[model samples]
Target: MAFPLMKRYFDPWLVRIRNLLKAAQGRPMALVVLFSLSLLNLSSEWPSNMGRPAFVGALDEAVPDSFRTARQLLFDQYQRHFPRIPTAQPVTIVEIDEETLATVGQWPWPRNRLAGLIDAVAALKPLAIGLDIYMPEPDQTSPDKVAANLPETAAALAAALRALPSHEAILARSLRAAPTILGAAALDHATDTASTDLRSAPVLVHGTDPLDSLRRYDYVLASLPELQEAAHGQAMLSVTLEQGVVRHIPLIMGLRDKVVPGLPMEMLRLATGSSAIDVFADGSGVQAVGVADVQVPTQPGGDIWLHFASIRSTLSRYVSARDILKGTVDPQRIRDKLVLVGLTGTGTTDMRTTPLGELVPGIEIQAQVIETIFEGRFLRRPTWLKWAESAFIMAFGLLIIWYVPRTQSRLAVFLRAVPKGSAVLGVSLHLLNVLFCFFIFVRLGLLVDAASIFIILSAVMGCFFAPALLRGDDPIKTQARDAQGREDENDRTGKAPGP
Candidate 1:
């Protein structure tokens, strides 16, 4: 009686297991298992291929460019939809706008006119004034040029010209009197020449050979020697573009074996009365650049990821050059403010594409960089982020392999198997990964690409289920076979089969 009871208890489960094995034994099912395992193996190699160009390119293409655009749009929308931290530090832009050009005349205005504008802004006692314009050559409207054209009174005119200072000299005097930071450009051409008279700001390095790993440039195009000497500080205005968009700005750039500060960095130093910039690095590369008490985190090559705010929302930040020069504007507006003087008139060719869309001024880009650093809110991808992503992909892939097969087997045995279940699981996993990445990006300002992992998950599901769904023996056939076997067993035992 005990033996009969034990047999009754184990017989049904044993039969189900045997049917599951029979359904999963055909060539079609074998191929599915083989393909799924192959994908698992391929996924294990993804981390090592992270640095390869082909692998990187493929990962970039995995998500459509439209998705990137949409991501940016979403970022903009969120910033607009939410309330931001109120800033106590005032930063202003003295723009050479269309209205200013129409009022003060077109660009390349007489050096005296520019000198007057500087003097007017200086009177307000701003924190620091940065010139985004480059003065590479002598002014065309100088006293000497005017004297040379008046040949009829050449002898007397030469004496008058000598008595009156050159336009450049007047501008230099104004620059020396005011708090000014001059901007320069980095060039890729090896033969490019920079002003030897201009002095570079002092840099103090805190690690072994940090400059060796920085983004190196062949030469720099700086301002005129006299002007550079007169300015309080000099900074490189070089900005690297990514796919025609301004995403990251370099805080320090390498020039002929020497490291130089970028415009935003130098301006901050001058504003805070810091004499030298302190760069901290390790074997990996530069870790941070410090000015006074503020330290900014940077990439290995001294690039900082910008957290952009919409220019339209910050329109009050700009003050027309004409208004500043005419003394009609309120002095309280710019008093103790950090002022950036740059050209923003139409056709200036200084516009850039930002996350907010096209036609952003290059000056605003630098302003945003300074703002981001000052706020200490940056977007960064930690060194271990990729490792975390790779580990996640591997673990999830293995889970699917283990869990999905058992699920399919059980479903097939119950005559309830369907392809939709696997497809639904794959899509749900994809959506969960997307939501996780989005949360990290918005909350912590970390960007981790989940597209590659999604691809791996989808592929694994497809390989595991496609063959089984298409060519494997139907669940109905398995059910029929089990019923017929039960009937034959009952006939041999001389009993009636159950309905």
Candidate 2:
């Protein structure tokens, strides 16, 4: 009985929709809806995903640029209102801050002093130490290098200086003392070919090659050979910016035909004593990165959508390098914690603009990534949302194409005074979708693209109503005007007009 009733009501609606589609106006509207669906990649074979051929990829990005920007704005608003609260207490930053720079002397401080700093932190027995700072070149202050530059007359002094161990050796020994992960930088252009052999944590790929999905670098700027040998792990410290701002940080990337983990991922591996990083991917892209018992969800290209927090949050603790070196730092702050060491002084720091609309130290971002992974407070874009949005746009558009013109005749008086009421209805439906997206984001940490829905709906509504709006008069109003004009003419001529 219920099925029969539903069909009785629905069959006529279906027939009406079919008739509407047969109309000349409805044909173009249907085509527009299909075009919008293509933009959202409803068909996978056409636009493909992010790493397609250059022109095709740009077309894909260009079409959805506004949608992406609006989505980012929504994300920024969400972040401001309810940023992720940092719950991983064992992550800390050992900052080489302004005070440390002033106290320990300017950067490029002799490697031995850096060694002392590392030794001090190592003494606290941190679970893992990450050097977000890099030493791409060997220290020029090494005793032998200084000795080689001196005059021959100062051979004895040079010999005495050379007799002592080089500062680099001291630093290398310090690195060995701690389970330290050294930083490497991914470069777009080839520099020295020597660093190609830089050691990296092993990455095990599962299901399909992920090279296309991962960010690629032509070369790498690795640390000194001795330092690389001493460090337990070496990983890229570089980050890819999104529209000149930092949003998602890549967890794994392609470097010189090799897959390597980023700084935070390596640190997590070291902390957990994980032997290797596992990347789970499909033809679409990377799904997640596995480190020991923790599985971290990622963007298709192995990037994690960084859940930002206020800089003042205690999600990660910070301690001054000077204090650590001076033994004034609390031991408890470093005990069993994953410590990231980097410069935070102005002019020498790695600054990134976060979604929270603040410039943050890159090391702090790494800290947040580590905490997010461990605590599993990830913001994800579900794979099905594009299809969901596309279905919504098409279904709502079909409804408008069928219902609007039919209602116009019945609601002539109300619509004539407000021709834009139809457009207003479209906007209200859009707002409802936007609010639903917001609710999903708040309740489940899912990032939905409200902009796509709006864009498609706007196009459909504009096309549907443009002809009526531009023509300036509909048949009903024209007839009413004609009747009124005949009455005026009859009164003027003193003759009755035939009905």
Candidate 3:
């Protein structure tokens, strides 16, 4: 009796709900609901939190990190396959490979040996030499230092060794003679309070103060005073990584509260003999970095999106240090090129993975940066792309929602003849959107988040189609219902139903 009463009361309400759902699948109301959902999606992705309420943080967290990560991975795949033919051949690497280490003994080779290496490279007259090595402390291998550690039994020998000229002094003379840029390491933790001398290129700021937009360092690990003062310039030998891959290198960064150029930027400055670097910025942050006549578009924090060439490309030449030291280097190879000196030995710690899946020396990345800037082939992720993606998801989702319901309406008789035709139409539109994003990336070098667009649309399609799937109605269901009604009529008339 209770079941009968419950069904009697709920059946009318269930019919009303089914009727409401069918109406929602039509115009005006469907568009409004979809538009409202699209706005909610866009609200969560607002770039800045300035004008929003407190709950936005919660909403943002609701969007899984996996989605953003997948989006980045998709972009990485695009870059990996993209063909980038470098137009400029401005950088060459002087690699200290396994052969060099074996021939010249292990790394931290006596500063006197390094002095000879510098002299050899300088004799060829490269445009500028960048030493991508950090010499934080005085050389312990210096004769004087070695003598100081000797036992009293070797007093005479110690005295003889100490009498020889200091190793750093010899290296300093070589550095003074060559146009060299010494590499400095960036540190996050503060060290000595007394400020040591730091060399920063003159930066002309055009828009807002960029101090806040730059990557900050508490201290800089610079070379010894003698060698640092002798070098033409000192720059940070640091790189910025995303997902453990070297994708962008900072052109300029903050060190000890002062702006200093990165290794690549300093190399560019010295090669072009630029007096200062011009930085253009706005409310959005740094827009570009200009050195002499070469201006590079940069991300907000003075980082350029690196356009990495294929590993097989010989655009940038690499000369072994062993060859350069042995006087076998061709003058044409080093002449007028910005030479970067770094270790690429098997056991070296500076090896980093590139987007191309090669483990390259950190110095090679710096060379790539210089080449990218010189060629002006930049990959840009514009600020407006997010809004455009949001709009696309809304418009495309609304279109599909409108199209799906029309497939069953008398107004779309052709569509009604096809079984589940709306799904097929929606999938085609999705494929077109994917191809459109690919074309934009290939033709314009624009980085669009196609993954997010796909995710949003897929969710919208799933939700819109879910109710109909749950109802389990089709041409077969309508025929079965008609047969059941006939059987009921036959049973009421006391006539046996025939199959």
Candidate 4:
């Protein structure tokens, strides 16, 4: 009696489950699995929604890293196909190249020589002059050094050398006289964490304190104290490079909890005569940095995405330091133009890789940033864009979930034509997705993670087809089975089977 009662209570639920499983044997089962997997992929907080992870959380980090490399390659191809033309901006690089080194003496030329260069550039009446070179120590070849190195027997010569002005003083005087913006570097491993009283240009904040949210450094390596005081502005020259490429440049960074402008930002500020920069930020991070009336957008840590100009075009923008010193360069190029002084000499380690795959001077990277800001052609990925991307992924995933099952059902009904039809449909869908992703990227300047999307699509197709192949339910196997059944019947009837 007890056994009968138990069977009556549980038998209906067990039967329903069995019937449901039987109904989901082929196409329906595949669809249900694909949909569930898609939901798991899209709803998760993984770096990218490629597909449902075979094992959750274990491969999460590796997937995004691989996708990033692929995305970078896609971006590189995009840039190659649609290279940016150089804008007619009045920004020039006064490069100390191999030619300049051969013409002028080797680098570490006396500070007086740099002073002379400054004076010459100032005479051209540039809008602003930025030294992408840093002066961490006093000139070693100064007259004071010579005097210290001399013996007592050469007292008269030492006296003459002592009477001569120090190289630092001369450079400081030039800095004071010209519209010069000095360069400084932020040190990550600096032993000194105490903030030095470096002369930083005034930067006023409008919305919220963006200092705490910016990339911070332990210490700053600035120009000589006198030079810093005399210069129109002082800013950081440290650049951040990722995977050997410079894609973004920091416009504002923190050193020992103090905010400092980048070399390019200071040059712009000095050029526009903006005494104080107005930074706008909120809980999200830095939105934009303003100088006078012009506003420039930035990434979370005050870095600007660089839309690098073609390398061929950048060649003309370089004015050799030798020419600048010899007065051979055209004044029109310097007059009212922003001049960046940096070393591009052969032995210099200032070379950096750009999106174009060519190595360029670090100063050129800064110049690109400044020029981009001036032109207001910033590449930005707004906060809302991620949500839009997620929506796209979800929508596409759903479409695949809905379409693949129907395709499987149709293929089963027309098993004889399944091989040819599946091939055509699969190729078409894959190509369509590729074109769609590329179009959105090129047209809208949005990255849609094509790699991840493709992975999801492939996963869906594999799930739908793998079971059929394994169960001998594929088109060729089904036809073979039917032929074998007819042959068996003919043999049982003692008649020869027909082909």
Candidate 5:
């Protein structure tokens, strides 16, 4: 048969097959195929986009660029539609900002000043106070400052924790007393630590190879030995940032075969007094729990999903250290509040630029995560989620075959024709997967990555329409044959050929 004739005859059948595949009942088979593909892709990171521009363009009119209000709208919308109400173990912040400098001191303010800040926040008598700041090493000027001032700070901070003696020992220590998590970013540039401040380091949360990722990091070790000597608990606030957004913070990483916890989990242990933290990540995703003794096996790496909280909600509630210092804010309000040491300064430039080029506040991001942990609401995408994604695609692909050719409405037609279906679908899969990791069941802890979903769509399209385009190349020959058949029918009907 001629190429055009062959294609013209075959195109419709292939399209029908696509519809049939969508209508396929047992999708677990497809899941098995896709899941096997995922397993073969054992690399730890999501595949990079070769045509990132095209992918971005697909989202151009869809996802607008607006950090301040856009991000808020997204969270609120997600909360409303998805409604993962966070069970926040409430905490406050003593942001080290310009104003904080005015009230407290400069960037690397004295250990005594941090001691006072601890005392002030300690007065709240929270379940625990966590320092997001780091104290990896000791201070030069005060060789014994962290150690020396720790006792003094404990003395003053003790006043607050006295009522709750356990709170004092566990919650009031500056990197020493409070359930502590230190911030440390792996140095991005191999520069001298000349102007380096050990207060807090930027962190990179996720990537394929930890060494290959250009995700920035900063060291948060303490500058005072005295400070280092007095803490009850300590862990890294390590981040695996993407583009620039601080997305996932690994609860722990492999270093000389040592197991560690991230900042939030460590502090959670202090706040809740739980000795065991169950870490879960199988085929679906990762989950962290503050049980007395967790039984999940250790992988070579880990990153706890960020349980996000809305920024407006976070800022409306949290008062800065500087505000508390000047008495602009009443201490009574913060009394019994769990406070976090963070950075939300105007000039802080503590902004992470996302793939979408949106600059988000690092502190606000942490606040959201804190709320996620506290609320027990996490986004989860299990291995089953990928199967679910494949199912959705197949189902929709069938619907497209049925509905697209018959539907007359351009609006409906546009919806079917565009990639929007894939976006909505992809986002749904990830949201379910990630959120589930933070809050409830960490089932099928597998990372499907966005690439898998894209691949599914491509496969469906290639199967469905490659013939349609080929058949269109020879419309004349196809139409001629179609006319000849119609003529035969007309001759049998004893009538002229229809126009």
Candidate 6:
């Protein structure tokens, strides 16, 4: 039969393979089995990319100190890269620092003083000025005076949100001249319950109660409701961090089925004239909103990638309220700038953990958000990435098995074949897909561990096939290797060695 004739011609290869099978006997199958399980486990660990609590908790606990240090490094990198890139909107801060506090009196200065500060900032004609401080109530009660009875104490301590109207009046005047955006935090403090008369923006932030960690925020007490009502956008100033480190932020949250940007994000979007900023969900990866022909950069989960400038120095570099109030700073400084108002106090604990494993300052995080929105450079790892990884892993592993063993020497063949063929091909493809978003083919938005799967499958294939090519001799089997070496020498020299 033709089959018999083909087998007769390829008998040497068949013998080598059979010999390898006999050598493997019972030990080689474990690699593939274990590898498959690992792949499955990895897939489940990050399913839908929402991130599991157990895994996040594990990372949090296992790498506690790592978070802060990592954030610092990333922040430094961003600072170095920022000026060179020339972002459209430069981030600035109008801080209510200790010096300003001294000039204007201690914490919660009189409503008129803040109102004057707002007016001064407005005079500079900045694009937007955000008030990081909350105005839940008017300074009706003088805590320093110390009230006697509980009822009298309650009455005296109850403050009106005088700052709201004050800021609104200032904003309205300034808005007529230029653009402006104000900040408001979701309520956790008791002060927000006080003012029914103070106006609030109609839009609200919405999110689920994940472990009730966020349940504390019940409402948003804006300093200027009337002004905010007329403004182009309003955003949530809330930020949750891991171990006091911030790495990522919510671009938008569902509040009453409407999409408004988060504090920094909204401000940046408003500054750039983009009404609808698509904040890709942790669930959806990345979806294009109704933007016209605009491409976006994104993280693996399709959100804007969080990057930061140096937080430590940023706090010190703040433009004080005193400067703005005194007319020393140019309106041009804030003119057309995207301003973010966030607390950097050590006592505050809104932090997040990131890949760099750091607890970054919340304000630095806002800076990152502003930068991303304006630059339009987002982070994304799309779906075709997943299929390409699976394909490359399978093909490269199989080809490595099929080709390398055909050479006369197993180790040498492995090294050469790996460089020229499967190994290089696999590694190159892997880096491209994971790092640069190459497999834009499927657009499915999934990714796998190319290096991991390849390592595992390669190990299995090596066990199954390589030994067969070098059968009748393993390097460790001295007697077999010696006999094969002798045969090889004879063939090369055209004579047997004199023993």
lDDT, each prediction:
0.73, 0.78, 0.76, 0.74, 0.47, 0.48
Writing each residue's lDDT as its tens digit, candidate 6 over 267-324 gives 6455556655543323434343222234344443224435444444344335766777
Model 6 per-residue lDDT at 236: 64
Q: List where candidate 5 sits over 4 angstroms from the true fold.
A: 1-89, 135-181, 186-226, 280-288, 292-301, 353-358, 391-499
Query: Per-residue lDDT of 67-145 in model 4, one digit per residue for the tens?
Result: 4565566666666666667677769888888988887788878999999989998999999999987787778899998
Order of models, best TM-score first: 2, 3, 4, 1, 6, 5
TM-score of each candidate?
Answer: 0.77, 0.84, 0.82, 0.80, 0.55, 0.57
Q: Determine which window of 10 residues in candidate 6 has minimal summed lDDT.
A: 205-214
Counting clashing residue pairs in each candidate, in order, gives: 0, 0, 0, 0, 62, 31
Give the poorly placed runs of model 4, Cα more than 4 Å off: 1-66, 191-197, 407-427, 441-444, 467-499
Shift in Å, residue 119, candidate 2:
0.4
Give the Cα-based TM-score of candidate 2 against the true structure: 0.84
Task: Please give the lDDT score for candidate 6.
Answer: 0.48
lDDT of 1 by residue, 1-499 (tens): 9999998998787666444444543323434544443334333333332344564445445533523454445444433443234254457899999999999898878998999999999999998999988878778789887877776757897779867989989999999999999888887774335532336789899986677668887767787888888999999888888667777799998887788899888988898999999899877778899899989988777887677777765678889999988888888878888899999999974889875564698998888888777777887755566667656766776666555544235643443445445445557768888777767777887766565566555665554444334435443454445556766898899996543
lDDT of 4 at 28: 56
Model 5 agreement with the true structure over 54-76: per-residue lDDT tens digits? 53444443433412233223333
List residue ranges in candidate 2 displaced over 4 A.
Answer: 1-30, 33-58, 61-66, 192-194, 408-424, 468-499
Candidate 3 lDDT by residue in tens digits, 1-499 = 9999998998787666545544544344456556655555555555431355656556666653535566667777778778577777888899888999999999878899999999999999999999987776778889999999999999999999999989999999999999899998887766763134466667788888777878988777788878888999888888987778887788888775577888887888888898778888877678888888888888778887777886578534889999999999889899999999988888785778887788777877888888887787888875677778877778787776666444334424443556656557658877877688878888988888787777766766555444354466653343245446666898899997643
Per-residue lDDT tens digits for candidate 2, residues 1-499, read 9999997898777666544643564546556664755454433323224345665556666664545676677778777878877766768899999999999899968998989988899999999999887787878898988998999999999999999899889999999989999988887776754356568889999898899878988778888888999999998887878787788889998986788999888988998899999999998889998888888888888987778878878534989898998899889999999999998889998799988898888888888888787788888875666656667777777766555444224443455566565556557778888788888877988887777667666776555444434445463454345446666898999996643
Q: How close is candidate 3 to the true structure, as a TM-score?
A: 0.82
Better of 1 and 5 by TM-score: 1
Which candidate tops lDDT?
2
Question: What value does the lDDT take at residue 259 in candidate 3?
Answer: 75
User: What lDDT score is found at residue 8 in candidate 1?
Assistant: 94
lDDT of 4: 0.74
